[model samples]
Target: MKFSLIFLLLALTSCSKKEAESERTAHSEPAWDASFFSPKTGEILSYRETIESISPQKNLPISPDQIRKRVLKRRQVYDGSELIEGKTLHRYSIYHDGSFTEGFLFHWVNGFLYVVGSFTEDQKITFANPPIPIAHLNMIAGTYWHWPPQAPAGSGSRHIGLEQITVPAGTFDAYKVSIRKNTQGKITLREYWFAPKIGIVKEQNRIYSSGHLRVINTIELSDRSTSDTSDTSEEAPSEST
Candidate 1:
């Protein structure tokens, strides 16, 4: 009887210890960033944060206007894709105002360089020359984008960089992120996390290309600025014309 009682106590203690360890692990994991995806559509978005000039080692203060200046641009040189052989090159620049300039496409196509047929500014939100959906566009902001965020209770950015963020049904992690210009030309590929943060903490497939792994990206934004009009716009009711 004593032996059985002692064994029971040991088993209970071991289970308790294991449970405590798991809790600690979970609690210690860092929170995701704020600007990783398009809030509207939940699509992956990437952008570079360019400063007017480097201020040595100090963290430079970035104003909203400063953030708006740096836009999304892409350059591609094809060595051998099904679309082009040898070397076909393309350079794209997307303006914050939803305007774009494509030297090659404009030089040859004669039509507007929008990937989608043609669109007005407001209509372009969905037609986003890049073809990003409205919902995805909502998640993505002009801020040199970051990661998916945790709720208020889980507030704060995770600096360690999540190799992979996984929930019961989703997962997100990246392998690498770089801009390469080979004989084929310039190509920027961002290896993304398998399952990134979603509406609720969930697991997902790597829908976007991230060089086959979760790419490490610098985090920005602790709490979104309340004074920003963008935040207010998110709260405003949508009106259809």
Candidate 2:
């Protein structure tokens, strides 16, 4: 649901030592462009998504409709670039189906994206100041980063090299970021793929409860459009976290 893109908006900011490792390791790797995730103002990107749910009750019968894929098309456009609290941020307007935001604000800090905050439909700031990294920026095939730099040990992400992942948009050389962990009897795994200049084109998630499959969700980029970047310009309002 909303978590698909919301998680994509949040991911990596490491401490100095880890950052030094990223710099050294990424120095020889293929250069990653910031435009892979951030487009110029007035730019728009579209995607067709399909979500499926599963029922793991082996003894019970499940209807065919319970496993049907729900397909949808979403459009997001970069409104402008703004400077908030001395940090440069990019502003975007996300359209669900064809409607405007229903209390969502996404921003990027130093190229890394964050949820930042959100508002009610009437513009009332219901929740205003949540800083979390769902994804890192300009990462190569060997970089490592985390959402909160102060997170507990062993909970972070690793760049698992680059590969050519195919989707509805076509074949793209994308960087794969993996997050994996097992707690008690539950296993949680997530993978994200980003193509240069096209953005996060695909994502997959799996949850295994007590060694049995609970659910699986996958999203792919079915279609997209990118306009010329050099001519984009717009002034944005000042807002800070």
Candidate 3:
């Protein structure tokens, strides 16, 4: 899965946040911003991910455990950059649950960050606009835009505004972005707090069925490191909206 909020998003479930934690994320303090989504090799960013079930339905129909929250640690490393189609795309390696899996590649087209490409099924797939827009740096408050314009009916996003948020990684004056779409009676909601130079500091994704929440995945940054190691791996398949 292309877990991009820390540059990836696929599908997920929902869970409730700890009492104290819930209060902090509710901060509505207005905020203001740096830059590098592109990093040197060996740069590592780690997050604490919590997966929880919000409805009676299990992630899998036959599963027995239906109520609970499970936390996992996920890390991403900047492997390097490559020239694809005459443009530079950064490659990132993902590590989660003590093992390596799919990674992501990002490139800029006319100044906007587009995922553009990904690795999947042992093959590489390249495309146009991705499911999400990294940032429209020039965007100001009250901005609205849609991703993968071909998104299902009702799918879209908005740059809500600037907000100050505090998490394990520290406090950041970040941009608040929200995305949502309802299709075939299923709805997906995603919100992200992104820091300029550091990328996504916090994010939450929720899926709903028949107007009821089904699952949620929340990720918060815990730590980060920048180095020159070459051990990182790569993600993703082309998605057509």
Candidate 4:
């Protein structure tokens, strides 16, 4: 009886060690290359944006004069790592149209990319109780995932396979993904095309209220530039927004 008890304790210890190792392995192994969507420290991406508003009651598009067009430049700068809500997340400063807009915090765990939170001015972060999963590291055609994990049924993102897309920057093969969300009788659909090394080449966003399209926005990459430490600018149409 004494020997049997010793054996049982040993077995339990062994199982506990195995479980701990498994957890570590899961955290160490990333699903895919994180750089697929995450830009480098000193990379700048310029995009041309066009926005069109539609009248829900009349179901007619707005006048041409009401449509807005502008050039948006986004610069990404490394902001070091921080511990937030018990998770270590990497932060990046986002500059929009040549001014600091916000800090984007990202966490990678179990091969998934999650947006932990965003910080506006002074690095003040507003945490999302549960980090939102933006993409699966190991994405493939038909891959699907939902954000706000507890969101309503029909709210999620899907990979629509790879396709050749053309923008002002030039044509390249890119992965196409579609994201849909439903909230308070309003539905938002966003489609994004990302190139391997280059980030988002194009994005289309449509918002529908009461089953009628209310707004449409399209953004296409106009140019992209990279620098080591200094800011670089690409000449495009005058900036707006």
Candidate 5:
């Protein structure tokens, strides 16, 4: 009887120790580094974009003739930084064919990269409520997170896995992440390939309407330059109307 009692005590102690270790592991901070996406102040990244309208319909805003097989050049410049809601966010000015299109503000916080806000044509800043989470710095395959915090199931971003991709710029072992959003009857899926210290190497956006595929737009890194010289070239022809 004494031996059985002692055995029971040993078993209980082992279980308690395991439970404590599991709790600690669950609450521990994840390993991540925001520098993986930190770009220099003067960094300039150029990309080649291909926009295709797979199944163009009359109701579609873009006509069938607007679909272009040719690739267009786009540029993004890390021009400045700002302090928003106590967070330091970097501003990226997006240009298409030398014309200013828009700007995005990004920042890292609590092991996550977020799109804190965006800039308008007049350089006005509009912040996102609760800031949209872009990627988890320490994400691994099967890791998942969602924006708006209370979004429904399956409406979120997931780390697909690591993939070796080749673009016009070069080949890189990038982490593939997928973000899905469903609104009304429309569904949009955006996939991003990020290379360490190089930011987004490729992006593909697929939009569907009423359960049918409609458009697929892809942007791949074609060239990157960190030259401090100011851009003064004339605007190139626009790729899309």
Candidate 6:
């Protein structure tokens, strides 16, 4: 009888060891796609790539500088009645040197999504105090704001995906983005519409699910500064024969 009891204890010990090994393996291995979260583990992972390296399947080639310019231009306050299901206002703010801040405030309500920056200086703030519009929310969608996966000097790229999309203007490329969390403990998902020549003309973000998107503010290009008059004034006059 004593020998049988010892055998049972040994069997229990073996099972416990196996269970511990399985748990360790689960935590060590990487995820499958890295875009979706692991429901079992509750951990999120995402792929990495630079904004300029992200290429469309069958669209015109766009350079990193061009993409950066387009991102700046799209950052501004927008007033739209159609997209928001009501009147809404979006504010996009960009500094002289290309630093960006985007804020969205709704007219009838109090809720806002503030995108404080990008890969260069990317931050997001969402609050229910004021409502930021949807058009502005779309601009910062996808690759516009880079969080998580940051590099050595607080810079990183976003990995995006494109699904089915249709718009009033025409059929174009639509993209979705998944941000891998940086050391800052932040993550975001976004969607975008890129027109062939105009670049990323529209975007949308579903941030925080509190009925408010921190980055979905609207803007008009007229609200942003796109040129420098100093260079033009310094140009030498050409004497014609």
- Top candidate on lDDT is 5
RMSD of 4: 10.8
Q: How far is candidate 3 from the true structure (C-alpha RMSD, Å)?
A: 17.5
- Local accuracy of candidate 5 as per-residue lDDT tens digits, 98-154: 899989998766777788888987868888787877766676999887777877678
TM-score versus the correct structure, for each prediction: 0.20, 0.60, 0.70, 0.68, 0.74, 0.23
- Between 1 and 3, whose TM-score is larger? 3
Q: Write the per-residue lDDT of candidate 6 for residues 149-188, one digit (tens) a residue.
A: 2343333334344443433223444343433223343333
Query: lDDT rank, highest first?
Result: 5, 4, 3, 2, 6, 1
Q: Best-fitting candidate, measured by TM-score?
A: 5
lDDT of each: 0.25, 0.59, 0.66, 0.70, 0.75, 0.31
Better of 3 and 4 by lDDT: 4
Off by over 4 Å in 5: 1-34, 54-70, 229-241
Query: Which of 1 and 5 is the better model by TM-score?
Result: 5
Total backbone collisions for each predicted model = 40, 6, 13, 1, 0, 29
- Indicate the TM-score of model 5: 0.74
Q: Which stretches of candidate 6 lie above 4 Å from their native place?
A: 1-164, 180-186, 209-241
Question: Residue-wise lDDT of candidate 4 within 171-210, one digit each (tens)?
Answer: 7677788989999999999998866546567899999997
lDDT of 1 by residue, 119-152 (tens): 2323231222332111121222221222222222
lDDT of 3 by residue, 77-161 (tens): 7766655444566677777886777778766445465566666435355464553576665656777776567776457778887
- Positional deviation of residue 1's Cα in model 5 after best superposition, in angstroms: 96
Worst 10 residues of 2 by lDDT: 232-241
Ten contiguous residues with the weakest lDDT in model 6: 41-50
What C-alpha lDDT does candidate 5 achieve relative to the native structure? 0.75
